[model samples]
Target: MTRRVYFDHSATTPVHPEVVEEMCRFLKDNFGNPTSLHYFGQKARKAVEEAREKVAAAIGANPAEIVFTSGGTEADNMAIHGVAYTNRNRGNHIITSAVEHHAVLNTVKALGKQGFTVTILPVDQYGMVSVEDVAAAITDKTILITIMHANNEVGTIMPIAEIGRLARERGILFHTDAVQSFGKIPVNVDELNVDLLTISGHKIYGPKGIGALYIRKGTRWRQTLFHGGAQERLRRAGTENTPGIIGLGKAAELAMANMEQEAAYLTRLRDRLIREVTEKISHVRLTGHPTKRLPNHASFCFEFIEGESMLLSLDLQGIAASSGSACTSGSLEPSHVLLAMGIPHEVAHGSIRITLGRDNTEEDIDYFLEVMPPIVERLRAMSPLDQETEFALSDRCNGCRVSHTCRV
Candidate 1:
């Protein structure tokens, strides 16, 4: 029997049992509409407010500054659209990087079509967005600078603090999507120097339907997504998702309690996987910044195979992983993050993102290392490039300067 291992934590995680219990209580015994004004309603409302405080405290934010939304997508939409709409008269330009998740990339692109000019800045080979480029791109018309806290695909932690400081000096608003970094790393809004931030619950072992957008006190932002009830301080309007909120609150508390030890454990496992894989596999490029990346993230691009093929093979072996961002799965195009990092199209297609979690173990790393080489060799053997470079498949090297010398 193949041992099942999940290495796609960047996509989502299994809900924590403690979070489930807290949510179940809200779902079964304490069920009520937060706005009903009855005892039941008050009970539900109290839970929601407590969740707001937990989420806010997890990131060193004020409880009043947190507004719950459906998920990161909605939070990102709120942050970008809200700021852009409120400040449209102030400026009509936005700045972002090429490597942001589609939720952000597409959001900014949508704004670009609505008469708001946008500057999509380039990134370095490590997928790090240059702060100097951000400074250079700024103009009087730039209203919002939205960059992610980390690259979801490559795991490259951006210099968000520097960029945030620059935005502050220019008196422009800055927002960072902290969906990936919220629970995995230490995320303090003041330390990052951002006016707004976004986080999702599911990414932190909580329920899926809940997320939050942090609007720093006195940030020139306005509600632009919905119009209805007075929920969420008139920032978002709807019947509160009471159970999901409670689950997220519990998850946040647990994360705050155990973050340091878990981060250190995953870092060791991640380093071992990274070092051994590169040592064993030839014709591979380690994606992302080597030193300053996410502790549990290890991404790579093999020379002569499609990432989807590797994924299928791994799945059959009861190992789960991702070709790139799970949101972009099944797309034939290469990862935008890898391409932005100056990796060739062919190389980018071979991208694989392995994000570890608390559930993973050192034994999981051992099994992965034991199996990965033969898997790569098999895929490479089947690739035409491995036989000889002539008529190589899309996974073939497209003038990549490497040691793949065999030619038919």
Candidate 2:
């Protein structure tokens, strides 16, 4: 029998059955537009509001602050563009990290075309953004500081709390894309002190095409995206995605309930996998901050073999994994996150990310461990690249803008 395992929760999770059950009421006989004034509409509206409350509770936020959107991408755009356009008079400068999701990086780039000065902060070798660096980047024209709570590719948790504190002190709006970290770890709006944050449903075993953006009260933000019927309290303008909202709410509730236990379980499995893989495979190094990364994430760079080859080989063995962020997996270019972490072009191409989830277990890890060694061995044996080419780091990183020191 072929062993099957899934280790790509960071990309997305199977929609939890409970979430589907919660969404059923909105989809069937009781279906009604939440915007209508009729009884059916009121009922749908009530359920949507209830879902809003649950999502807010999960993140220690007020329900009024949560604005539903199509997913993390839309939420991210709403938060970043909203702040940039509304606060443009305050400052035309925006600050972000190099390892941010393209949703953020590209949004700021668009803002730059509109004459807003943009700063892309570089990361350390571990893919962690620096607090002092953020402080230094702030000038009189710096209005918004957006960084992700955790990286999608390497899973390194950023110092969002510290950065948020600094942003608050500087009177700059701080936003974080928590799409990959919301359910997998703690995400309190107050604890992180972020003025805005983004969360997605599918990442947490909920329906796709639904997400929320947290906008702190009193933040200078306006509708930057659409012009339609007043929905999401005039923050986002569209008919509400009632089913996805309800599913996401249920998923949030369930994740909060099971977080502590699940985190511990995944941590143990992650540590074991990290330990065994490095011990078994020669010339491999773990990516991301070893201690500051997500509890369920274990990424590695295997010398002399490209990540696409390893992914194909693993898929043949009935294991699902990824080279990096599922969003940019199709890009042949090395991960910007890995390159930002100072990984050379050659080694970054060989990176693989394995993120465990609530459904994963010891048996799955065992099966993966059983197959991974031989697969990596086979891939390396077939490779024409040698250690000297694979191991050389300085040549590629020199004069590259991805790393902080290298850019300097």
Q: Write the per-residue lDDT of candidate 1 for residues 171-219, one digit (tens) a residue.
A: 9999999999989899999999999999999988998989999999998
TM-score for each prediction? 0.95, 0.95
Lowest lDDT block of 10, candidate 1: 392-401
TM-score of candidate 1 against the unseen true structure: 0.95
Work out how many backbone clashes candidate 1 has.
0
Compute the lDDT for candidate 2: 0.89
lDDT of 2 at 324: 92
Runs in model 2 deviating more than 4 A are 388-408
lDDT scores in order: 0.89, 0.89
Q: Could you tell me which residue pairs clash in candidate 2? A: none
CA error at residue 224 for candidate 1, angstroms? 1.7
